[model samples]
Target: MDIFDIVGPIMVGPSSSHTAGAVRIGYIGGKLLGEPVKKAQILLYGSFLATGEGHGTKKAIVAGLLGMEPDDYRISDSFNIAKEKDMKIEFGEAKLNEGHPNSALLRLEGINGNKIEVLGQSIGGSRINIAQIDGIDTNFSGECPTLIVHNMDQPGHVSEVTSMLAHKSVNIATMQLYRSAKGGNAVMVVECDQQIPKEGIEWLKHVEGILKVTYFAGI
Candidate 1:
């Protein structure tokens, strides 16, 4: 029960869920990719697939991928902007097995060949839930600096990550862990109160058993 929940977000929108939230989803997707988006494959689901066009959902997503925010007045002109920047974008519908009505899956490729897949949902009032990253189940609001680590499900991995964060003095606001199975792939979604230093991220990349690390400096 906050002001944003009641009044919604200040955005260029015909619908908060479709427009504003779509922008955020794209924004987060871009951040997770870690570089300028060179190509984007956007798949809409449920309500977003049914009525998103009329609500400017497509343009909003493209705008966010171009590094625009929800309140950016240029959202409506995102398609042209993307073309000008040589960003290739494709849109389609997604078949998700039981999820929120306003959901989208984005497959993004960066200029440097970095790629990421993100499944995000707009619950309401411009708030979002990033449900999956690179096919791993995740749960984070993207409201804080988030650290997502993909690693082998083994002993000491969790403690290693936590210890590093503690050493950096970054407080964790919330953390969730998910795994495919015992001794299989695992992911840690850690939302922190402070921005993690670039050196810390680089250090974590070299840790053994760590497969991938994605950090989102909060919007």
Candidate 2:
């Protein structure tokens, strides 16, 4: 673990779980949605639903939906500001096992009819995980522009995508490649240090064996 993880991320906080981790999860959820979350249904599961109010989880989620970072001063008034921004928001309980304590499920709908679903978990010290994006199970922390590539399970596709990123001077942080069956289907969660260009996107879209390319950098 990095020093930040030990001491915690530089952020506004009455509690790291409700504030920083919640904000990060919400921010990543917004990013996964691919646009501003005009309307959202936030379901708090397990620990989040239990102690979320005192930790300001709801307010932190709203802050993230409005594009405010955890360190931003605006996190305190996110609920009031959400109204001014015309964002419709709701809070409720969720169905979850005892897997992760700070878990949440977000159903976000954008203005352009783009719909997305995200399930995230805040472990501790203000860190979280993006467990699932849409129906794909992924392992990413949402610290970068993550590319969740759904493709036919085949050889050389990973190299091709990595080679493209290398040509653009983009750096990959952590990559997790998973397959349900041989030559059937696969998923690659590539987190990058830089934003992906449209040209790169077009290239990846047409790559042989690649079925879908869902890129989520930031909201």
Candidate 3:
């Protein structure tokens, strides 16, 4: 096992799972949205909802959405900063069924009408798992540059995406496919060793059968 797994991340926190991990969750959510967040509806689940306020979970999440890192002292004042930036913020409980206790669901809207829903869980030692995006099940740690594609479940779309990445000299470290049902809504989650250019993303968007494309450089 990695040594850091025992030590945890460097963060301002009373608890690693509640504070630092929660920050990472919000941070990843912000990155997925790929724009300035204008509004956020954060849903806390299980243990998070029970004692998050006392543990600074709420502030950490807001701080993360504002692009602050876990160690950012500004985390304590994130709500004020969000207010100054005119970002609307709200918090509520999530009725998660068979979900991890240290999990959250983030619904975020950007200034330009972009919106994304992210479900993230803090497993332990400040490491987190992005469980879902826009209701599509996904499994990525946000440890590497990731490409998420929402598309129709049709033939050849998978090859098309992989081929595009290959043409750009991007090497896929890991790739996963999830679908709502056969020949229905689907998502392609790819973690890459190399950074993908903006042009590559645009190309993926215009590919026939592709619905939406989102990219996140590892946090």
Quality of model 2 by C-alpha lDDT: 0.83
Report how far off residue 84 is in candidate 3 (Å): 0.5
Q: Is candidate 2 or candidate 3 better by TM-score?
A: 3
lDDT of 2 by residue, 140-219 (tens): 88777888888999999899889989988889988998887788788899998899887887799999899877787742
**Which RMSD does model 1 reach against the true structure?**
1.1
Question: Per-prediction RMSD in angstroms?
Answer: 1.1, 2.8, 1.3
Q: lDDT of all predictions, in order shown?
A: 0.92, 0.83, 0.92
Worst 10 residues of 2 by lDDT: 1-10
Question: Tens-digit lDDT track for model 1 on 107-198?
Answer: 99999999999999999888899999888888888999999999999999889889999999999899899999999999999999999999
Regions more than 4 Å wrong, model 1: none
lDDT of 3 at 7: 69
Worst 10 residues of 3 by lDDT: 1-10
Candidate 1 CA-lDDT value: 0.92
User: Across residues 1-219, which tens digit of lDDT does each residue of candidate 3 receive?
Assistant: 878767656799788889999899999999999898999999999899998989999999999999998889899899999999999998999888989998899999999999999999989878899999999899999989999999999999999989989999999999999999999999999999999999999998998889999999898
Q: What is the alpha-carbon lDDT of model 3 when measured against the actual structure?
A: 0.92
TM-score of each: 0.96, 0.84, 0.96
- Who is ahead in lDDT, 1 or 2? 1
Instruction: For each of the candidates, give the backbone clash count.
Output: 0, 0, 0
